[model samples]
Target: MSDGHPFRGNWVARMYERVRKCGYDSLTAFAEARPTASLEELADELGPDDIAAVQVFSGLVAEAERSGKVTRLVRGQLVRELAENLPDGWPAVLDDEVRFAVAEALGFWSAYTPETHKERVKQARAALRATPPPPGWRPLGPDDELLLTLLPDEEV
Candidate 1:
């Protein structure tokens, strides 16, 4: 998987294609269509690679949010799905880069205001911290600087 990316494999690619083939133009659309679908159901449909599905979903969500294709409501739904579905010891399956990407996306989406956004960031960090990487795996910390840079002075 691209030397080190845990999510850049045939399975994840196939999952993306399957989402496209399901009459959805993008992953965001697929997520929007099944707002109530559990993550377990999605993972089951994608194959046995639930970890890869999570990674791919996170990446897709990040891309959609960055592109302005995902609205606040949809973003919230996706984030909630992530929080609810990820399995125990899930962090062990992810590499530092993937973790950083996820943190970046969460941080970006969580930026709402000085007060509320700060609380969101705190919660995101706590969640990430709770899942430590596997033994000997060097975990990357969240990119707070990037989040700060992306967040505007005034809330949008």
Candidate 2:
């Protein structure tokens, strides 16, 4: 890690140690605390030089899987993506800029989505594009009213 790269050593232990250092017992709790923060933002907060965004996400996914809360994680990820890509929230109209921003957000969200929820996340993403949310709509958290309506909790 002396070379200034974030990926090095036992990534699992490294990430979790950083997460604990931030006063968070679980990665999801830390992530959900700042629902709108991008993965890069979270990683940077943990350790810009030793923690990468992917490590944060990997820890999040593993925790979510173990806790049967992957859907919540997926939605939370969407919140992060939206905040990063749509600083102005949903556009007033679906112009070129809006489409590109939305695409970037959705693309990154989809990438983070787990295989178990890929199809459902895809459907949710399609629904959003087919019928965009209101202008200036920015979800503050994963439990946002509109988000829950689009992709409700399904784990039993």
Candidate 3:
């Protein structure tokens, strides 16, 4: 059996490949449609431990995105603060209450003004156009709720 990380390197590699093949914009769009969808639920359905790890990972990603650490925003402050605040990273960043607070803050970010959202949409479309979709895979289906729920806003 594998050790430590539940997801094998191959699994993560496949996920990244699938994501790149599908295009991040399309993947993002597909993930954003279902607002009420629960990522935790989907993850739980897969396995409780898996969901927990994913939650921790997502929390880290969301926090990084918010502070502009991941998205090329302000670098030094967020990095230092986040590191100081959560040495163990997101899971230990804060207690349950603080975690919810962080999640709420991240949620607010998803609701950019119409103009900004439009700009984002335009950028996403442009990116998708630059990278063609892979063979065999069709566009996200209407019933792809699981994927939709995993967005920064949703889930997936």
Candidate 4:
């Protein structure tokens, strides 16, 4: 897995080309089709040899920013991170052990967040922890009700 997508030649162009070949007009479309797939899985689907997860995310972020849908992307990222780190979904309990797992997932989401949205993501994280969504609140996609409620689209 190339950390920064060391692939030569316009990597973003290549990424979009692969996405189009997969019958999707954008990376978001391809990713939305399999919302829970990890970044690594998305990259592997695009091009295992040259594409990387970070590249998949980079392209997605660029598209999202241009479309003024960064909030949606942030929520989608949380879903992906949770899916990968908490495969069984949010636990029904909030015990110390479970707390760590939850923190780990959120931490990764924060780490992957775009710089401009870092502060907003931090606030969202706090709200999620404070409210503590129901026992098993596993969001299948970015449009999940709670996510929208917590972090409404500031762009619009």
* Candidate lDDT values, in order: 0.47, 0.88, 0.34, 0.88
Candidate 3 lDDT, 1-156, residue by residue in tens: 223343744434433344355454322332334222234432343344422325323543554455443331111112223333333433423468755643443333332212324444344334433542232222232233321222123221
TM-score for every candidate vs. truth? 0.40, 0.94, 0.25, 0.90
> Least accurate stretch of 10 residues (summed lDDT) in model 1?
138-147
Across 25-104, the per-residue lDDT of candidate 1 in tens digits comes to 66666655555444455555544443354554565556555665333333343344434433232344557765665565
Off by over 4 Å in 1: 1-8, 48-51, 69-75, 78-118, 121-156
TM-score top scorer: 2
Question: Candidate 2, clashing residue pairs?
Answer: none
Candidate 3 overall lDDT versus native: 0.34
Model 4 alpha-carbon miss at residue 66, Å: 1.0
Instruction: Kindly list the per-residue Cα lDDT of model 2 for residues 57-134, writing each as its tens digit.
Output: 988988988998888889999999999999888998888877898999999999999899999989998899788899
**Runs in model 3 with CA error above 4 Å?**
1-6, 20-27, 41-156
- Clash pairs (backbone) in predicted model 3: 149-154, 149-155, 149-156, 150-155, 150-156, 151-155
In model 4, what are the clashing residue pairs, if there are any?
Answer: none
**What's the C-alpha lDDT at position 2 in model 2?**
34
